[model samples]
Target: MTLMASDTSADVVIVGTGVVGCLVAERALDAGLSVLMLEAGPRVDRWRIVENYRNLPPSMRLFHWDAPYPPKPWAPHLETRVAKESEQYLQLEGPNARAYLQGYVRYAGGATWHWAGICWRLTPEDMRLKSLYGVGRDWPFGHDVLEPYYTAAEYAIGVCGPSDPALQWPPNAERSKPYPMGPIPFGPGEKRLTEAAARIGMMNLPAPQARNSGVSYHGRPPCCGNNNCFPVCPIAAKYDAATALPKIEAKGGKILANAVVYRVETGEKNAVEAVHYFDPNKVSHRVTAKLFVIACNGIETPKLLLLSKDDRNPNGVANSSDQVGRNMMDQPKLFAEVELAEPLWTGVGPVQSSSILNTTQGEFRNRYAGAMFRMENFARSPLGSAAALKKGLVGKALDTEIRRLSACTARLTVEHEPLPLPINRLTLSSKTDWLGINKPNIYYDVSDYVRRSAKEYTVPRLQQLASELGATSFQLSPEFLNSDHIMGGCIMGSEAATAVVDADCRAHDHQNLFLPGGGAMPSGTASNSTLTMAALALKAADAITAQLKHG
Candidate 1:
């Protein structure tokens, strides 16, 4: 990517260089508009990240996945695993504090660098939660409205899904076009779970993923089952936003890293006049643009908006509705660690390849939350080695113990869909970062809807799976955990008084400013939300292009 210049004027200034902003920048540049993207974090090389992860300390490698990319002094993300209040960049408190301990990083690519590559699209029922299930807010439009954009996002991101429509996530995804590549074959462990789940009347389908299966697409190679997709991908097979930066720059889009945007300057009629940011050295810089889009994830996006307040907009930039940071949501999750009678042998493919999706949608949503389950495919060598070393085992004995433990152990996860609660809010913390900006303070609770499902619907189903898998030892986590699929905070709706953004993700308070991605999602189903976020980004790009061309 080209260097950032002193001249920062552009037609559009996007506040985060994650996939959302990168896609928006690409579309605006394609429309011949001058695009400038300001990223809070520093630009990093992919190879460098891979090497850093490879050489990290054993403890850090096992526990601290974000250790590879240390946070910049100004662009700090939630770093410390410790629950100490003083050490947190994102101050989380509620009935479920552990549930909100997110693992996102402040790097050039955003969180996708450490993702499992799963890409599940939302079903029609997922969008119309209020109308169909009598609970939660519904999307402004239906699945038919988002179908084309979903197709476009899948092709742009090079998604691979099952060839058989019956095996698709939405029971034959309503696709205008087929997947770019067929599904990756499941490993022995995945196949075993698929078969067992089927006998129990559950459909465990192959997951639609972004990484390639056997052929190359858009210059990236196919996955070779490296099984270390958590910290780094090692190779450029999986999709990451960092890979999109150079292409955006090649098309005349300017990206400024280490530029921590703190204020959104508004002028007459609440139009976005400019945005001001502080560099790592704490020197502030301001840039003017005709329009602005804040594509920082759910947490950071709301934090940035709350920081930008003026006499005309006292509550915050888009607080005319007082909804900038309300309605925080996530797919609250639980894990079940099981040991089988015989070796199950996970880690034969990507970190995740299939899931039991039948539970994600049902008529039972009126009572409790719907949940989905998956067996994690992370290689067990590190965990096995740790277990073996603790026993004072040596040499061949150590190797034998590690081998058996890794092969026989498995982790099953239950991710429950959550409702957008007004109480689950993200506000500005009294705590300040190294740049003297207020950190994000979020109060999160999984709520009774999710908890009811865990006790009645999901936990029972998990027990059945463990029984079917012939688990000699079974241990389910006591509390709900964060699936890392953050949503809400800046909710969307038909009324300007209730929602932060409009149907096109444009902020209601400021016509020229758009707030897209996860923060604007009204509902998040029991699946990975990244693909849905990408579809929304492309949709927002269309609106931005239209405004630039005709308005």
Candidate 2:
């Protein structure tokens, strides 16, 4: 198939039609800028989405998994080098290491199609990590600067929650408006845990989720509370990028599906000129734009910039600082399952309904930790519940154990703060994809802080709580843990050497190129990254609008 061009140019061109990209497109259109969005997946339809979810293999039916689809011509092969088991403890290379991690949605709606809809705001201290804790570098701007944008994003997405004083951290920002909807009602399991946590001097509160509890302002229906949130939502109750695409289109923006962006093009002075993309048939096309925004996730965003190398910029486009793919970080997540002594009603509502703020503070403060416990209701699916029981009980005694403790299983989730490690990074591989563009080679490893925090600080406290809650037994997963909330790889800072983009999200070397996504986060916070990504996009959009008007 031959590649064809649409209208010659747009005011802004965004790559990746995921949650962040859709938010950026909508904001740009609202600013009266002509926008074009390129997605590497097929257009999504409601019926097809349901079918796709139903077809997923049972093993891969987790909330983060999306339906299988043909990969774009430029997509990388699923094969990669796996680190040896002996090297796992090296803190750099290991058997579980992922050579290329690409988790973005290929469908028109992106990953939001199957997300659990947990929305959270990064604590104020999250903004100045380097300055406050001397760990990760500080963001050029603080939470104060992002407060208004956060308000805008929450309202636009119809978030539901009440501000909890206990969960509030230092350097807090003011909210200009309230949540668009009310919070989800707490289930019996959550109520028991909340009461238990408070009895133990822990502050437990309802989780602020993006799942709608009532008619949304954006025309989507309320959530049906179908225990299945991952893989894909059969109903449009959860907020997804698709909901925002229509608003962008209404403002005259264009979204092109199955368009895989390869690399950015630069002019004589190294100014961003255009973005090159390959169609499903592997035919290359170029779209010129006054400005370009890379909303591709953490890994692909830097990979694209690195592959745009030329004689003028040997390292790559906007590589003067050599920080495009450095400082990679993902949340250090831990899971603990406890068998309860009584029936707490484990099969209702979303799995993660409430969280405790006690272990998140004090000596663990520097470690950056938070614990969220959901009633085992997430395991309502027969296959999922049986798997959990088997994994927890172990051996041929599993059947006897299931009958012995049928009503007593609850799970606790602990998300630890993962600081950005300069050594843990992303680089371009010599191997090229079908479009002749280099693939991304990710080098990620958990840090000592993450390991110690999970073992010393998080686990002990969780064990104490489980015992207090009358848990007969408890077990923890051994995976190092990667979160749906991927961040860094294109960190933002005041200086160019340590960061790729500036406080406003513009590339340090090329002012016309903006990176609006979790990739620009200086450090991964304990919250879901989608809401924060939208807020940052809104801030960047405002900056872009101001620059265009002034210039």
Candidate 3:
């Protein structure tokens, strides 16, 4: 399976066969371009797919609370050198230093394989954070420009939700039509919270999701409602990038699995000419193509660019702007749990069914703050829930408390925007991995704005909502203090000095090279990033097609 440098060339070489890469390949094929998609993971076998139920060990499951998790068999060879944990704070150096944060995902479909498909479009204000809120940088393109692309992505991926008429926050764009599928069923906990929020003058509605509730347009079956959406979808109810790879293959694009792209080979003018990768059997291969797209998640994408050092571009490939790996940001999450006076069914549907815009504006807006609270669906397994209950309620009568709290428990999650800081960034370390490439060193710390915003603004609002819902005892989950939604690093902007890609998603230095996914996001909004990432990929695909047609 190892493909060497003498491997066949392609019209377009896509590094990383994730959702974005697959979409890009599909678009390339549509434009009459032959595509070769390189994936570091092995080809997926449907029979080998395991159910992500709570019975499995945390390490095997996604979203587990364990460090030094066992690396997947197909993990990139270059990733072995990544520091496990450093005593001294390691500062990154070099032009692409900012983009070196440690990120995971070596599977063929990437992180989407373990993602919760809570879909929400970035608010219009999100695109112009600097112009409107005087914080963060404005996106080169606004929500208006991405509306059409968003619609296309929605249909392609089969989104489910009703357009909110309230129009708060960034507000969704004018949809070409409604969601391909209907909203997921609201659980009893969501019903109680929704009713309580509405009575207290709060706007609560069914949160838009990418999970299938019924037969979807794409011929995918509805979600089985196993309450396990994070790790793996046993029935493919939730949208994963794997769903799109077949479509790309059907369109004549070739997906080369078990191919780990090590670097982007550039020519005399610093333009990428081919992607250098190693196959499963340690065979080195080079895929020459007219265009190269890097969608290897945020961390690896930047790392690959930095590793592609050449005499012409001494710093790295597409490092002329020195913004390849800067502005690392992850939405820090805060969770608040409330025990309602009346018992409510804890699990009956998707984990998050209803959301409220309690603090989307006002003083929080001026501080570049994110949303305050949303009614999260409690989909934790019995074991995990038992662990949560034990942590929050500590008393002699533990058994009695667990029995009483099982039916009435409810949790709300607050997603706050992390302020992009230069010091908290990614860089290449001296440590070398099996591939002989330096490991990606990540340094991340939540900003004061994020900490203060969650404690001062969000926590209070959540408490007040719980009080209004006639809750007896309210406790916040300590585990939620650190956010899971990771973004930034390789952000898109108008200038090469400030951003990695242009508004069109083309690398500033190399016109034919593109980088998509969370890395391209200028700012991580309150909503889930997968939808936005897919939308941006569609937009980039269109731009690439136009350029190919014109040239």
Candidate 4:
């Protein structure tokens, strides 16, 4: 694994080749800037991951979804499916340690490689949480400023959603453009749940997805109802950052894989001078650029900034305000397992199709955190077998019971939005990894706001929804889990003293450093933050373009 180091300079250099990083690199290249991307993890082929997933036994498929994508020693990521392995990567403490066991992989394509591809947009109400509800902090700008970028991101990612405005989430939110393609029709289980939810005055809307619906999009095939978006998507129907790598290269953007960035070098006027990285062999290399963007994961972004501490930035890069790793946020999740008399016949389409979007906003936010709900559409055959086997049934009785439970069981989910708190923080751990880099130590409390919401508001509503589904028996999961939507580490604000980045995601302390994507999000609305992250990436690119071209 011997590698040579040479001086490489570009107009803009980005760290992390995830969706957000790729989006920025693509835009910078399209704007005729020499763009270079440094990825800590090795490049993996999608087909190989798909084959690995297909080789798994049916019993292990659902449980070990991420087993196919093994972590390389130099580039390790948390695998929550295995608690011990997860703890070794991310040191977690606090009252809700299990909830903070964030599951993400370090690969050139980024976490999008194994994502559900559901893109939930933040509403105007979400941006103005403080003004309207007097609970959480408000965004620096309103939804109107971000709408165009959202639309652009949707088109770039090839998203498909319902054409009818009434069927869209936040039905009243104004849109800058229609969806790129029509939505995928709901399956039998989704249809039945929709009807039941409607009777209870809940609207289940089709979630905008990064997967192609019917016809092929951007040279990618359409989804064929495999219900296997997790782990791997066999065909390129779903939008993964890896799929954009070739296009980026075609546009003259160089991607250096297996190059982990550990430091951000600063120079005169507090501008980013260059970035130093380590190859898999621990060979150090210096990459200089006029401008730099570190689009690493929410956890890794702050960790990198903190790791880059120098004489000038003793607290950390962009930590003059001492908020680089503060305000950690994620959508806290709970589950409800229901047994119904009639078969829901789940797993007809994608792993997730629709969710109760209306519950995400309201006046109730003044008292408790708001929530969003969804019915997981993962194939239930394995769960059914596991459940039926526990009953001690044998022979034909076991087979019959499996069949009944497979079709009759449903898993409903609720994600309660968390307010940003400085206490929910990530710090450099004493523990070190293979590369001797400090592992991330996180302190997360689901917070009394989320606790009260689940206890007083969300739990009762979830039970009410379950009752409407005609459940013969229902059990609610007692513990809170992560939705894997990480946010707020590098929080954005208008003023420099209170926030790490500006609205455009430029680091407040460094003129040439822009930290975009999930880490820069101010508020983690009760939905997937992937779309908003992509939009922020694009918006940051626009700002970078203006600076480089106009100046």
Q: Which candidate number would show the highest lDDT if scored against the true structure?
A: 4
- Local accuracy of candidate 4 as per-residue lDDT tens digits, 1-551: 21122247788999988899989988988888888888888898888888878887876676767778778878888753465653478888898877877878888888879899998888899999889988778999989899999999999999999888888866866888899999999999999989999998888998999999998998899999988889877787999865789988887888888888889998867788989988889888899988999998899999999999999999999989899999899999999999998999999989998999898888989888989998999888889999999999999999999999999999999999989899999999998888889999999999999999999988888889889988998899979998899899999999999999999999999988999998888888899999999999999999999999888
Note the Cα lDDT for every prediction shown.
Answer: 0.87, 0.70, 0.69, 0.89
Q: CA lDDT of 484 in candidate 4?
A: 90
Better TM-score candidate (1, 2): 1
Candidate 3 lDDT over residue span 223-327, tens digit each: 777775555666777777557778877877777777778878878677788887876666787778777789887777888888887887777777777776677
Query: Can you rank all candidates by lDDT, best first?
Result: 4, 1, 2, 3
Regions of model 4 farther than 4 Å from truth: 1-7, 57-59, 80-87
Pick out the ten consecutive residues of candidate 1 with the lowest summed lDDT: 1-10
Q: Residue 276, candidate 2: how far off, in angstroms?
A: 0.6
User: Candidate 1 at 149: error in angstroms?
Assistant: 0.5
Q: Give the candidates in order of TM-score, highest first.
A: 1, 4, 2, 3
lDDT of 2 by residue, 440-535 (tens): 666776667766776776788778778778988898877756565768878888888767888889998888999988889987756567788888
Q: List the residue pairs that clash in candidate 1.
A: none
- Per-residue C-alpha lDDT of model 1 across residues 1-551, encoded as one tens digit per residue: 32232347788899888778888888888888888888899889888888888798898888888888888788888665543667778888999977887878887768868888888888999999999989999999888988888888889888999888899878855679989999899998998899889989888999989898899987889999898877778887888865688888898888888888999999987899999998888888889988899998999998888999899999999889999899988888899999888889898989989988889888999989999899998888788889899999999999999999999999999999999989999999998888899988889888899989998999999989988988998899988888888889888887999899988899988989998898889998899998988899999999999998899
TM-score of each: 0.97, 0.88, 0.87, 0.97
lDDT of model 3 at residue 141? 77
